[model samples]
Target: MNFDEQINKLIYDWEKHAMPVLRGVAGVNSLAAVALLIYRYGFFLTEEETADLFASFDLIFLIFGMVYLTRLLFQLDRWAFIKSTWLEGVLNLFIIIHGAVNYFFGVKLLLSLSLMFSDANPVLQYQHVLSCYLLLMVMTEVTKLSTHLSNLNIKPATTFIFSFLLLIGIGTSLLMLPASTVGPHSMKTLDALFTAVSASCVTGLAVVDTGQFFTFKGQLVILFLAQVGGIGIVSFATFFATFLSKGVGLKHQSIIQDFLSSEDLSSATQLLRRVIFLTLLIELVGTVGLFFSWSEELVFDSFGQKLFYSLFHSISAFCNAGFSLFPDGLNTSILSDDTTEFAISGMRIDIRRMYGLHMVVAALIIFGSMGFTTIEEVLSPSKIYDRVKKPWKDWRIGTKMALVSTALLLLLGTLAVFILEVDQLRHDKTIVEALITAFFQSVTTRTAGFNTMDFGSMKDSTIIIMMFLMFIGAAPGSTGGGIKCTTFYVLLLSAIGDIRGQKNIIIGRRAISPTVVRKAYSILMFATTYNVFAIFLLSITESGNTDIGILQIAFEQVSAFGTAGISMGITSDLSSWGKVIIIISMYIGRVGTLTLALALSSTVKTNSFRYPEEHVMIG
Candidate 1:
């Protein structure tokens, strides 16, 4: 054969044979690579240890990357990889060059400038950059796997549950590692499990002090879990998969539709794209606002630490995960001087001193709880201009209901909390401080766990009010749990219609669908029944302990069920059974109100014939 013919034959053979083998090997090794990198990050390795670790990783990447690139070089002449367009090939070329440059040259340029101002040494900084790149590669491969999974005939609800459960189980094992805790001995398996569940579920109930007990590496693991849990692992993986593939398959779109609670199958792909971009955008904006809002007096010694705090809290708030790095949450004014001394950053500084930070967090929580679909409707650039031009005509019923309900709840909660706490707060804090705390409490109770006041010190009336708010939670499709505001609104309207003796329930001249009303009732029934059963079990297990009260147990159960994370100061004192109960409740809350019901309930055949009419019991 001539040279051109031989070259063409070689390209075809490589594309048919060599590419898969190389990709398969790299894909398998990518897991181990990621695991090793995570271990290195999760531990407090010394400088020598850190250097040796990355050096090994650097070697592995160098070998595999070189082989991959050499194979690519051979195939580029025939455009074996980039089938669609020349630009794709150019992009591929750029990515390969970038990776080679970073890996081979040992350039510490990326993110090194930020590390220069922080406590991170050059060795650690370089390790971080390497770890990040490795993580990106692993995630890219994993996204491919996830997209493939959608081809199977698994229910989306089942997939959602399995994803969280798997993450929780893995996270539990990771947290139980020796390096995860600060002390020599690892945490109790139960405590580690509890923390893992909390983080994985994005429900902020912790059995241990997050800041004091966990090392920086451990904290990072928790943060990783929260981010994974917050946006959902499935959603995260699929977002990248969609980006890489440039579009989603029909099955993948259906799965994404289920995850996002989007009804329009046609827009499922668009919704997935919107969900990811909007989440990142909002979180970025929130982080910047928080960075500026933080008090100078409470500033961290390192710029990186400050940035991490902003990033962590921003994710936590936006995800509606109440996990705070502060031992006392945002209510630092109540912390004793001795307890406050251990804080390395001003994150735990007095709440009154960081009023701006509180507002920023509150805003983030509100946006998070508003649900992605509602936010898309209100914030989408194309709609925003039209909305301003014709506010009433442009907005959908779902968007309007979510916004109106959210506003009403916030207003009612704020007023109730302020009125109930005014006398007590008036004596203990300034009027403005008390008002801010009340406002913050009002927002936080509904699916956010952050607090400006001690939950344990609140009046019984306030506690009851908070329980109601937590039970209602945020809007449907939001990064929160509970019955959802729409459910609560439906129930309220149903009652109002009954009282007025109207046959049809109407809102803004739109008659409600019986299916929607039935669904809303189903959610309420499931949530109420679940909460009651959980509280009952918790009371039984926790009654033996003298330090905690039944009300506190009930409060904790409600908080977990709501994924609100606020505790009446008894999360750590709970027995093993109590912790398990909270863990299950958190899991249920995060999975959602109707989802849990649907997952457990078997579908039944619909009877074509109508049953005999029967009268129900009187209310």
Candidate 2:
């Protein structure tokens, strides 16, 4: 056989023979992983306690890491790990180093190594290294499991739903742990589940003040959930797996292409790589900006605390989760004393009163909500200069639609909100603050949930405006969730076409697909129906119990259905049944209304046979 044939044969042989053994190994590692995870997150363990607990089964991670490392070293014929990119190889190398140090040098070297990361807390370094090792093991096993699942011929959509359900379930369980909560009382299971759902759905709606009620471990759990859920669990797992093995298989690429809504399977791997890289890049930059914004605030207890605050908010913002470390979300100006104030340029400002911070956050939200495809079209490395110089040349219709719709929505939303709330804003704030807040509110209303002004205090007209904006949310395939700007845009074009007595809906001289328009209508109708149903349920469940009005209840339900999370200060007081309704709304909204609709549908029946069509009056 030639080189290609030989390589193919080798892969087949490995899969036919070696995979069984690897599967068994992965099964064992999964059990060990469970124990390790519990030990790490189940309780507040001291440095010595953590060390002792790790010592109990310390060899498990080491052995798995070494095995993968060996696969990289001696398996040149297999071209497994080495075939992965250099960055992945470097990461695996660190895993091997960690495993070696743990096996050979044990606690002594780990202590010395801990100094490299944190002098005051070497145990954190140890924990970080162990977490890395565990991650490597999990990724390998998960990759294998996914392959096996694909072999069993599971549908990608079904797998996607299951993966999210699994993440939410696990996150809920972890957040319910006693150590995850602060103070005397533990977090109720229902509340924990709600928070877990919100975080995993990247909805940012919470029953408790995240900074106050959730311990560091809990915050970390939420942060982890947001990241995984923002990108999607399957994409997140497979992206890391691609680094440890050969390129992603065609089947895997097909599934990921569907998940990301990419052009095709051919670009799925490259798209995933860019997605992960872009997410991290944007979050890192946001963190730096936030760090400077908060550095002058001096509210954090330590530099590490401030750094974590910045990092958490950055990730949360970019993920469009709307989670804030501040107790009142971003409305910290009213909640905290002047000590938390910061100097921007020359003027002193409260954390909540910082217009510059709001602008930075608004930028993150806009970029995040634009969707990766639109981002790639405009800002990808190859297109960056072309976009600036040529400006709209070669842009896709979707890109143009997204940009135009976003701008139009932002302008109108800002103008509407500013005009409606001018009296309220002008009472205490300057014109600049009022304008910035209006812009910020407009940017956030479409999806990102961070609120500078309290929604509870806003007028009903403003709330109605916000509800409308939230209903038509961020663009498709973005971290932000809703019916999607494209879906709404298509519906609008269809309406306009009907008014003009046109059959084919056209934009920019390009005819829109009939199928696409139909799908958009279906999505819009389904979303509206879902929101109405959810609102009815919440109204019945929370009526008379809450001090708030029906409008507020409807607002909250729409927010949940939109995955917007901009509540009118009634989320915490929601009845259990109401919470359940919101939870379902959040889940369906994040998963896509049509995705749930499809999953529930009997099957995709081909319309080979049809009865004679009869025109029916409508509108």
Candidate 3:
């Protein structure tokens, strides 16, 4: 053959055969690599003596998976190979393979790997734990890459995944340090991860007394986690660097869009920026208030304690974490004691101390659970100025609904708590203290579990009040949990609409979207199902403890599930099994039941081409 003909045939074969080989194998190779990761790392190192090995291996594997993912992508895209679907398929396949391996090998691995390394070196432990976190960041990248390859935006998912992984890593790092360092001998990575998750997810369940467990350094770590958690993972990440690092990629913008739930290009980044600004603004104001209130007792004390206290409580309150330096969650000493009538209440802090703490904490919790949209709508300088200029100017639908719903929830909560606890208040000094305790309890019930009054001896009616508030929770896109106040409002509005035979749910002259209604309903069902599942687990595991009742289990489970974290002093008494259940519940609650559902949800999309809608029987 002629030289020209030979060259032409060679080029055509390279394009058709070689390029296609890479594209198809992207799916296959990525899957295999991830599968190998599970069998080799996550499950195989379960013995206690192999703790360091397991830790080191898990750390290496996590980072390795991330690195390997990029390497695989590099091999595929050495050419301009841009098919993201095949990549996603491969990633999904790998995750599935890992899941299968975990179920098959997890128990054996835990028994084997954990036992081998229980007394491992602290430095090595730190190194191993840190590596796991870095690896998590890589995994997050993979998720982002896979989602980008899909048609949907995965920014929110990416921010969430990365932040969650980072939380575990930071918590582990904190717990591994000596008391001279970060202030703990050694905390379980999973437990620390749980605490970190609780702080980052802003759910307040603690296996250890956060006040007594960690040193100031450890407390600081929790504070940092709570800040990141309260702000939404993306907001914190974006604070340092937004999409502008390399001149703003479309994938980054899409991720931000998802995280903020903002479709407007102008406001996409604005939502994150606004959240950061609002968080700092609230924390700053809160710190000042707390410092002023706190400084009185240690009146001549140095600035350092006041500063640290200010920083800690501000984040705790704003995140709605309810983790306090004080042993008994909230001070009931001279503060506000809900159970001054109970002998156990004296072991709680003095009442006078709690009053200032209560008011500051209450204020912070109010802002934290109030929701960002509410902050922007109700407290935005521009909106306020505009309102001053024109009182009748319409506020955003989100703002209007948020205000009405929040007001109704708070008022109901306050009034109900007061009425139920008034008898207990009579033993206390004045109406002021009783009123403050009732009001503070009422406000925190919506999400934050901070109690001016003791939570343990409260009437069953108050617990019921708390349960209802927790179920309703904070507002949409807020720091707190539950189905979310906005969701509750929507469900109520939707019911009203249905009763009236209306086409759509309407509130404040604005019609709510069907998709939103469906999501709200989905969240409610998912939350209820999860709480039930956790309670079921607790019932089997904790039935032996006479002190712990099913009601307490239900309360603890819902508190964790709602990210509410109000315990009936039952958490510490729970079996490790029960603790594990609560940890899982807190993780799910904070990352969000929706996010977890989405994380575990089938990647398999339903057929885009739907069949005709069929009529169904109605109640």
Candidate 4:
């Protein structure tokens, strides 16, 4: 045989014989990586044990390098293969270079870089890099595994619900580890589960003080959960699979379309990519903005701490997950005191206000709550270009509806809060400061869960207004949760149509579909029913506590159901059963009421024979 023919035969033989083994090995390695990471971060290891862990990590990297090299060697179109797996290729190349340098020169490249950039311990920084690399590897494996989920014959809604449950499970386990808490002992199971649900659902409610009770490692776990939960597990899995693989299968795309609320299955993958990119892009910009916006008075132990705070709050705000590093949330006295006392328009305003930081966080919250689809339509480069080319182009009806509803809610909530608390607000702060605080509260109450003023101190009327806002919550398909603004808007439109004696509900010159209107009402009814049941449960569970009233119980129930996370100083004092009830409420809220109903209810096809339609009694 010719030399070329011989090489081809050998390559084909290697692929035929070794590829399956390699795939199995890769799966094992991914699982090993996850285990190693859990051990490395989740425990307090002795010096010798730490050394052994690092050694194990290096060995894993070496195996990964060998596997990549073997695959590269057998590929006929090496360039195409490398391009398809560029991210993995780059990581593998870095691992190889780091390994070579450590072996040949007895110097760790990551440690050296850590020393150059940070004042923290070099070894610890090096471990962080390795942990991050392992995390990436784990996520890649997860995405690969997710592609096989279609074979399980589960509905897309069921898959979506299961994804969050899986995330919460993993997060709970991680948070319960010894190293995750400030105390020597691990977090209690209930607290860990509650925190995990809050983070995974992006609800931001916490039984423990996030800033004081958890170590930095624990906070990191929460951050990861919030980010993944914000974008959604399905989106992460599908995006990674599509980005790394040659292409996504039809099944993956079909599932992704439901998650993204995309009508066109062909563009589901593209929308997923855009959503992820936009999310990260917004977060990065927010981080930079927050870093600069922090008042000089607010001190950190180190630059890394400062950076982490910025990054954490940025993700939390953008996710509408109000997990804060501050003990008292945004209303922490320290944060308010950190701001400068300034004057505006000849009015001497001596009161301190978190103007810059609050505004930045509010903006992030607003953007996140607007939904990815709306964000894409408004901010995407292609859309901008199209709009520029065609000035007459209008936003989709959904976008218009979301925008209008959000604006109305924000305006109404702001005015209501301002009016209700005007005397109390003006007693302690200037008009401008009061206005800013009112605005921030309005922006956060819907879904962000941030508080500039103490909820316990607010008037009952103001609390009612906040609850109304929370009930409506954010836009559909957004990170934040509630019945959703679209649902709220649709119901309002339907009400208006009925009042006007019209057969159809119209908005933006387009008739709303009956199916959509029905779904909207279904969500509302489901949400109301759940909230009522949850409030009753909470009332029964906490009946022994004299400090807790029905108003507080009801407020807590609605907050959990809306995933708003605000509470009247009651989260930490809840009984175990109360926490469990809240946990269920958060889960139902995060996965929409309608989505859970769909997931639980089986489809029943009707016979071809028609039956007479019946009218329902009026409310």
Candidate 5:
């Protein structure tokens, strides 16, 4: 054999024998990284203990560097391997440079750079950067491991369900760490689980004051859970796998296709990319808008603090997670109190009347709840280009239905809130302020869960209205939950058709399929049944509390099931059993009840046969 051929063969054989062992070592290193992170940040350590942990990190980095070099040496297509793993390559290069500089020159590069930005706590800042690096490494390994999930003989629906469960488990464990809370004691197991589930489900129901109870590290964990949960764990995994692995297997694509609701298998990857891109783009825009929209009276410790607040709220808004750093939600004095004033155009104005932040968040909630499919149909560049080329072409029936229904719902909600709450408005609040608040609440009630007005003090009639809005929820395949707007639209159409004595329900000159109609009603039936059972359980569990009325219980149950985070100020007062019931409701709501049923049901279908028809009594 030629020398090149011999060398290639030698490398191949060596890799075949050595790669598995190296991978096993790498796996251990990843776990060690996780443990180190938890140790370094999740607990108080002595000076010596901290030094030893840093030493361990250096060792881990050295091992990672050696593994990457070995793989590069053995790889025949070295350039291709580096290109595919450019992110890892960059990280390794940074580690090698930092290690060499620290060892030989006695210079802490990361610490120096951090000091340039802020002189305060440079050591802590350096440690945080290292923690972030470790986190990225863990995420990389997780994406690599996720590619193997398709090999398991399980339905996509089952896998999807399990993915959320796994995410919640991890989040719970992370939140239970000592550093996750503000006090000396760690979070209770039940409370941690509830928060984890709430964040993972993007439900926004909190048993504790998020801003007051959780430390920065804890909030970061919650933020991570919310982002992953909002987009879906499966989609995130698949996107990273495809981006980092160069390509995904057909089976993986099929699974992604199922999760993303893509009609074309070949387009699944493209759709995944578009969904992530759109999400980030919208979030970025929202962040910028919020950065400028905050009232001047709201003081932050630093620019970084302000920026973080903006980013956190932006993500929360778009995810419809409804998490806020403020104690009173969007209605807090720092956000919208009437007494807080800001100078605008050389005149002092009530910060509550500014309304810019509320408008931005409301817009984000509307877009987020509209679902990716409808967004793509309306806003995708290719679609826009095509529309420009052919102005006569109309939107798809599904898009039309979603848009029309959403508009009608928003208008109805706004008018109802305005009329019902007119007498309840404070005398000092102006007409414009009341209208703005009404508009904001109307937008948030459907699924966003943000509150500018106090629901606890509102009329019971208004609470009933909000519950109906929550029940309808957002559009299908969106981040928000409930029966879904499309399902509600279908039900409405079916009812109208029946009243008119029509044979088939039609919209936009096309008849919706019987299967589609059946599925819509099935979703409604399942949602209603589940809500009734959950409310009944809550009633039993909360019987001891005389202050908790049926209206509050029913409202809370509906809010949880709809993934709407709004409450009548009784969330913290719930008994342990009541919390557990709400947790299950949030899970069921986030992953549709029909999806959970499919995951649990037998896959085998019974044979189809004809049966004799019989007349039945009408309702």
Candidate 6:
């Protein structure tokens, strides 16, 4: 046979003969008997004696690092390793143990450290904890990216859920541990789960003052949760594998690529490599800029403090999570505080200087807000190389839609907020400063929730503007919330199509698919339905509030649901049920309102043949 034919035959034979053999033994999970034995026997230890158990965790991680290293050296294919003979199956037990113990112990270490938080200083404690979690998160995300970049079949989302669930289990176990005298009061399961969810979700709406509720340990735990949740644990796994191994399997690549998303047929490894690289690039630059920007005022503090602040804000901003160590968030009060203050604190800025910082921060927010798909498409090396070579080359449709929509949204958002706030400039500065703050507020309103002024005092018109910004949200597969710019683009385009009597919505000379149009419309409809429902639920749960107050709550609820964290100073006053509603909204917002819906939507086989066309009544 010819070379191509021979290769195809080889692949066909391998899949036919080899894959099933491996599947029989290595499909999923460890031996049920071994797991049962461990569960049955492993829970007999007391807290006082468990130090050794955790210590073993460190060793197990070291062993995994070594085994994966050895596997790298042998250059054995993932399929070869996964489908090893029965003799090698004996060793697979150790492989499973190594992976499991390392994961278990690593998770426990974080949970234990959180339980030991002292009251000495929450900022200091959380700073340290957030660092550790970021390190771990980056490691895990890298591994995830590496696996996906290398392979196309490994499931990144499933892996992410598994790792997160593992951490939750560890957190639950930690909450059950004996209460420390220095830590905040004991955690009820619901509260602990709530705290964990908030961190993972990266939503800052909390029942307790994250600052004072937990001992330094408790807050640190929360910080770790935020950092982990913010960057995506799968991305951490992807980055970790990158540092250790030279290449990833295609199956692993598929998993990571699926999560990062992209255009055309780019490989997952290339996509993940860029994603991890871009994440670090933005964070490092942001941290350095923040540190230097604040260095003059924060000189009296320890070196660690400045670094932690830089790191915390960098990750938090890029994640598009509106978490702040400050209880009131990035309020005017924080602007005056030396520690957690904005970079502009105490340093008098000329209008020009103010403009520069405004531009810099706005750029960072924009970069952070851009979706993974946007980054992969517009900024990726291959696309960049092609574009450089071919100046007239058209951008990918997603990139075009994202960039155009984001710019328009920001411009419209800025103009609307400025018009509303023109008469309400309550700050001390020239008209330039008012513009700067308004511009920042405009950018922040779309879901970053980083504010320079009080949102509570805004005009009713301003509240409506803020709601629209929050509802439109960031681009598709991005960190921010809303209906997503892509959805917005398609819906608007579809409307335009109807107005023009076109068969399909067209953009940049390309016909937008009906499937895409339908999905976008569905997302918009569901978002509207859900927001109304959230308002109804909140009104019932927190009845007796003013009309304005109700509107504010409704606005914030939708924002949170969109993963847009803008609040009108009412987040702190939410009732328990109200808080739960907000929490659910935040979860849906981050995971995506439509993403959750799609996940819940039934998946079934489709006919290969075309369906007969049918027309329905007009809207």
Q: Assess every candidate by TM-score.
A: 0.87, 0.89, 0.71, 0.90, 0.91, 0.71
**Tens digits of lDDT, candidate 3, 130-172:** 3444444344344443333224445346456656776666566
Q: Candidate 2: which pairs clash?
A: none
RMSD of each: 4.1, 4.3, 12.2, 4.5, 3.7, 9.4
For 79-148, candidate 1 gives per-residue lDDT tens digits of: 5344432333343354466566776996445445546766756555656766776776666666666777
Considering TM-score, where higher is better, how would the candidates rank from best to worst? Answer: 5, 4, 2, 1, 6, 3
| The candidate that achieves the highest lDDT relative to the unseen native structure | 4
Write the residue-wise lDDT of candidate 4 on 1-619 in tens digits. Answer: 9998899888988897787787788889988988998898889899899889888988788888898899898998899999988888888999899899999999888889888998968778878887888788767666767778767877778888888999999999999999999877999999999999999999989998897788888999999999999888878888888877777767678767876678799999898899889899999999999999887655555788789989999999999988988777887764323322211223322213668888999999999999889999998999999999999999999899889999999999889989999987899788888888899889987688788888898999998889889999999878889999989899988898888999998887898899999998888888898898888889999999999999899888888888888989999999999999999999999988888888899898976898899999977
List the global CA lDDT of all models.
0.79, 0.79, 0.67, 0.86, 0.85, 0.61
| Range of the 10 consecutive residues with the lowest summed lDDT in candidate 6 | 26-35
lDDT minimum window of 10 residues, candidate 4? 342-351
Report the poorest 10 consecutive residues by lDDT, candidate 1.
83-92
Model 5 misplaced regions, further than 4 Å: 1-17, 73-79, 97-122, 334-354
Which portions of model 4 show Cα errors greater than 4 Å? 1-21, 69-80, 93-124, 334-352, 614-616
Which prediction has more favorable TM-score, 2 or 3?
2
Residue 403, model 5: Cα distance from true site in angstroms? 1.6
Question: What's the CA error at residue 258 for candidate 3, in Å?
Answer: 3.6
Instruction: State the lDDT at 476 in candidate 5.
Output: 77
What lDDT does candidate 2 reach at residue 90?
63
Any runs in candidate 2 off by more than 4 Å, and if so which? Answer: 1-18, 46-49, 65-109, 115-124, 147-149, 295-298, 334-349, 386-392
Q: State each candidate's clash count.
A: 1, 0, 33, 0, 0, 44
Candidate topping TM-score: 5
Which scores better on TM-score, 4 or 6?
4
